[model samples]
Target: MARAPSSIVVFIRQNPRTRQKPNNQIRSLTFENKEGDCGNEETKPNPHREPSQNAQNEFTEIAKEVSKITRTKPRWEQTLLSDFPSFNFSDHRFLNEVMKHQNNVLLSLRFFHWLCSHRGFSPDSLSLNALFDALVEAKACIAAKDFLDYTGLKPEAASLECYIRCLCEDGLVEEALGVFDRLRGVGVCPSIATWNSALSAFLKVGRTDLVWKLYVEMMESGVFTKVDVETFGYLIQAFCDDDQVLKGYELLRQVLEDGLDPGNAAFNRLISGFCKERKYTKVSELLHTMIAKNRAPDIFTYQEVINGLCKKRKSLEGFRVFNDLKDRGYAPDRVMYTTMIHGLCKMGLLGNARKLWFEMIQKGYIPNEYTYNALIYGFCKIGNLEEARKLYKEMCDRGYGETTVSYNTMIAGLCSKGRTDEAHKLFAEMPCKGGVRDVITYNTLIRGFCKEGKIVESTNLLNELLVQGLQPSTSSFTPIIKKLCQVGDIEEAKKLWNDMQSRGLTPMVYTQEHIITGLYEQGYVEEGMEWLLEMLKHKLKPREDTFKRLVHRLLQRDQSDDSLLVLDFMLKIGYTLEKGIYASLWLLNFAKRIPDLPKHD
Candidate 1:
């Protein structure tokens, strides 16, 4: 079922995914006296411009004998020189023949090396591509990386990039980077397409860690000319995908410096990335930057910024952006209005949350369950259980509270208000009585009991939940353990912690830290230290108070050595000690008459 290989003619043409920006906007970027160019321009070859049917027919026959000779002959040079004595080995067609057995990349490389070094000829891009494609198909990427050095860049700088493109297309990004590095090592500069290819490859492999360096190399090399916005979009999108929105901003600055106003699409991608990263301030910067380029913020941009701000609980700043969008004549859409309402509710700005809710309704936008649930949750959060009840009843009246999430939100609100009887009635009704029943409902009820200092009740219900074959997440156990610590029932908390581990569940870092703090406060310092080390094994650092408490206890016992050791452990775990902790350490160190402890950076 193997399809015939597409003629090499297909590759030299620009790929279909490449979009063209307006030519007038593209600016030429020049390499300013940088090294590695060897004073020669890398000539881009149109290797596939010709169909060359005659060339293919000749290569087909040449490949058969080359493959047979390569398998049987000790010295390919002697046999190749003897059997193909009349053949012009320097010609592109003959190189294509040698490259057909690209399965033996190292051997093909040897033939390629002998031909270039002895015969003083380089293979065309098509033949080199064949070699790379074979290596890529075999997934011998580590071998491909080393093969680049053996080929060197002396014969054809164009082929190096061609190989890089092939490697990138196949997701061999590391190999692509290796080839790109070799391209520079031997005094040859990479093309803009090669730079873009490596950037794309780095993005593919999720190595955004090194993407900026390659981009900087591309800019400084000056090998690139007439760079367009679409090309810049590729890089902006990559930075955005990796949640490195600042890098996207820097790319925008570079694109502007390159004299092209990156269009709204690029800005949108960065805005979305900023939103996802909860960099609310950067979202505002991106919007203003877009406006500076004469591009207005679109609906998606506003939606992302508002939602992002809401996530960070910066509803006031989100409101400013919402108002800004309105001022610019962009009528707030349903999503935009809902986002602001959700953000306000989350921030406990119930007054403004209600105002926006009514405003959106007056503007003919219908409130969805999200709008209602957010209002209800906000009311519940601010201790306005009456308003929360009213919103929940209104959501059902308006035919929007049929979903399990709506019921769960109402149940959670009631539980938070200590209306356990009402929450219980709602929870029971969720199955056959009315709505959907799920883990959140049980967890919420359990958490409510724990918060109300009803640990025995919470434990009984948890055991019942296991009896009903319901699996509990870490969240289900966290609240109980945290509440147990709050009540100083450390034995019960330890049993629950063990139960969670026995069931193969990983507890949250904050949960363990709380237990450790509780244990430490009760003078069980060794036990607390043991749990702290376990938390560290899971890559979780003890919170500031935990460290300070431990260090202070050591100092209280006049164990200055132990206190300093604890401080060093804190620093080793990458904690910047608090100012109070530093002052304590300074006093302790002075009293101990030791050389001054290392100063805080």
Candidate 2:
């Protein structure tokens, strides 16, 4: 008979295996033919053929088992092409996995391209949806739209929802509405999820009218899915934001009527909004209602009430609330204590605020930046700069960075104490990280320089302010002019007045009066008269006392004609020139040998 075809065939090269152990060894034996003349069938049973075929079958079985084990393992562990087999182009889960690990959308796109090119798969709805979600989450709406257009994928409700959410989050509510319309055009009915999402978007941006309309539409459509908690919470928030607290309460009542229990977050938001509006009585009632409903105030609720009371200057009431919170076993955390302390300090109750501060420390609450700042400001307000400085140093030693308020307080305190040099030193040493110095800092330093009789230095500071792109307030210029007048620097005072006018800082009536008085005091009678005329041109009446002093001084200096002119001007201006006019006329007669001074205008 012809030799049988080889039973074993090698499709692929076999992997090498280690030698077998003694327990795994195979035994071989030879058998003699019991019946003679059995021809080829009796031949030794073709040991090589049987062994080889059996070994080949065993290898095939083992290979299949290994493949099954690998296939059952997690997708992440498998080799890319070997186990991936085919790309699930429509699976958003894969895209989400791509996005979750790889933040780059472009990289994700390239990955999809590679999958299509190498795996011979085209992009499907699920893949497009995944890309859309990834882009929405990443806030790349425009890119997502471009990709969808490129892939020619129709907009599904899920994809539209994602796009609409992204648009709303980006404050493009109009665009979101357009997308919703497009979704409707596609014949996809809006689910409750869709309406709720749109309604929430409207609520977030204070579009209450639109929210109500949407709610009505949703109800009339008879597609009643459960209204999400977020929908109710945002609606309440919108009402509160619009100062419609009563309306919000009414809505909450409606929620209950609808058999939906308002969640804690909704209650908290409503109460916080009421407190913000200073509707304290309403807030109290809401608190009671929450309690009656077995919903205790959360930390945020307690903090909100405390903050509101403090803001309204009802510190005593705030303290009571604090005590009530503590009695109810809700420990006042650091923020609560800080809020109370700050409020008390603002009310000038420094002693009480300090006591609370100590109590907070004793209660194991570490003082934070706000606590220290409040204490510093309180001490400063009470004129206890020494204590404020001590606390400031303590803050520095503890490595807390000096905030702008902290630096400003110290600078202002030093200036108030007439310690300009120390103030300047501290200001110069201020760390640059707190951003550029504000206008208040510049104003304070300039005013301090003026107070110290350092007019040039003050002017230089003003110049520095200009160089630094800062505009000086009217008050910033007032002190310098006042300082010049106080020191009898008439010429410099006049220059400053001109400078102020040039800079469009219209001199107030009081400021012009100061300049006139300064000129007169410095014996610049002619200049003083000019300023008085300017004041009159601006429709400002000079004080009677100032006019009397000017006239008397002019007459004493033998300037009788000038004195008479001022008296005539005073009469023209409707000033009551009784004693002042008589005194001036008397002085004029004595100076110029005239019997009476001309007073008729």
Candidate 3:
């Protein structure tokens, strides 16, 4: 007997050892299958008999020849017909021989095409299935689609459904929809499972619009005359993705009224949506309902609830839920532990956060970057830079590379504690230490420099910020503007103000107030009055002290007309003049006979 080729032996060995049949026996079975047109000893082989030696030799010769042809060139079609003119195209043995090179589906498909064109061959159901199996196995979705259309072969409905599912599973959703539409146009309704698979593919890719469209088409086309539980589940997901969670909730109610279990996925999605919307009450109600219905919420379900409570500044409630899950014997994963730790840190419950941190480590969950940054931010918020620094060092030692957030929090903490020099040192080290400085980094350093009255350093940083191509926000400009005004450099302050405007950054009341006060203090009373009027024109009320200071500065300069303008502006905004300012204004009015200020009603 001729030995099988090395490729064939290798292919046989790759099969599971649990198969009781030996390699020879498996290869024998392939020849026993039906051969449609090629002349054979019998159409049906005897079930009790083994393949004869001659049949084995012929199949081996075919495998060897096909392997040689596949290796030589792309134009194997002519060589294949010349080599195996009497080969059985419909035989499973031939398919198994050709599919040994299944890794190259193009070769297998071309061989199949050559068989059809030159040998006048037509594949049976089993042969077609083998082709589809190879195509799907290789994830050659586009090629499979073209082959199906080119041949105009109408595979059985089940085969088509399976192909649709394979198409969707491989993320070729648009191609899958084309197959689905073809099936529908031919008056074939795919199974509900296939429909759900298609629906899920759309949902996974966030094409909620297509999900709804297909669902409506599914209903209108009478594919599913009655919607099932899975259909309703997909509909709920679509509504949630569309941000219409309320409508999804109503549909869930309808599903419940009809006594169909909408399943755990439906419940989980609704919980996630409610969490994002901060609807903790609805989340709790659904959690209890899931438990009551014996559709017990999973880890993700509880995580959503805990995350929601934490976001609404309700960490206390979140902790309670976390404990409840623990009491139920569910071990929280690192992500869940991190969420609780973050919530605790945000609420300044450092004692609890520290306990959870140790507990997480003890429980064999390593802290990630988010976990360390959360605790670090909390420590920074409370002015406990030492603890934050220790945690940061540990985080670095543990190989959780220092993040921009960690650096920013530490820098801000140092600056807050009047350690501007240390903060600047760290800021300067960031780029060298593999840290990318963002706009927030420059803003923090600029504010720190302004706090120390280092006008030169602050301005240098502001210039560096622009050179770095970072857009400065209102925080970046406000402090520097105030500092410049305090130093009587009102011209630079005005320049920064205009620059801020040019950047389309709106000045908040703090920035406006500083500019207004700076103008008056630097003896630009008219410009100050004009700025104040600009604010008033926009219905922005300056601080009462700022308004009074402007009036005082104007009066001291003997600018009675400007003071009258100030009084008129203040009265228009419904401010009650101070007793001192009222008296001063009254004396001014008597001296100059300026128009009387309007009396408050």
Winning candidate number (lDDT): 3
Distance (Å) between predicted and true CA of 361, model 3?
3.3
lDDT of 1 by residue, 1-601 (tens): 1111232213212231222221110112111222232122122112323323444444456766775676457566655767766555565545555554333444554566557654436665556555544544444454444444444423356656666787787787776776777777887887666677777677767787667667666777675464567668877887787767788789888888867888877888887787777766777787787877778777887777777777877789889989878887888988888888888887878889889889999999999898888787888888888878887888889887467888888888888889877888887787764676677878999988887888887888788788878888887888889888887888888889999989999888788887887787777777887887777777787777778888877777677777777788788977777777678767877887876689898
The TM-scores of all predictions, comma-separated, are: 0.54, 0.56, 0.63
lDDT of candidate 2 vs native?
0.69
Give the poorly placed runs of model 3, Cα more than 4 Å off.
Answer: 1-97, 100-103, 106-133, 142-160, 224-228, 324-330, 403-601
Clashing residue pairs, backbone N/CA/C < 3 A, model 3:
none
- Using alpha carbons, what is the TM-score of model 1? 0.54
For all predictions, the C-alpha RMSD in Å is 15.9, 16.5, 9.4
User: In model 2, what are the clashing residue pairs, if there are any?
Assistant: 90-126, 90-127
lDDT agreement of model 3 with the native:
0.77
Between candidates 2 and 3, the one scoring higher on lDDT is: 3
Residues 501-585 of candidate 2 have per-residue lDDT tens digits of: 8888877677788888898888888888988887878788888777887888887787777878888887787776777567767
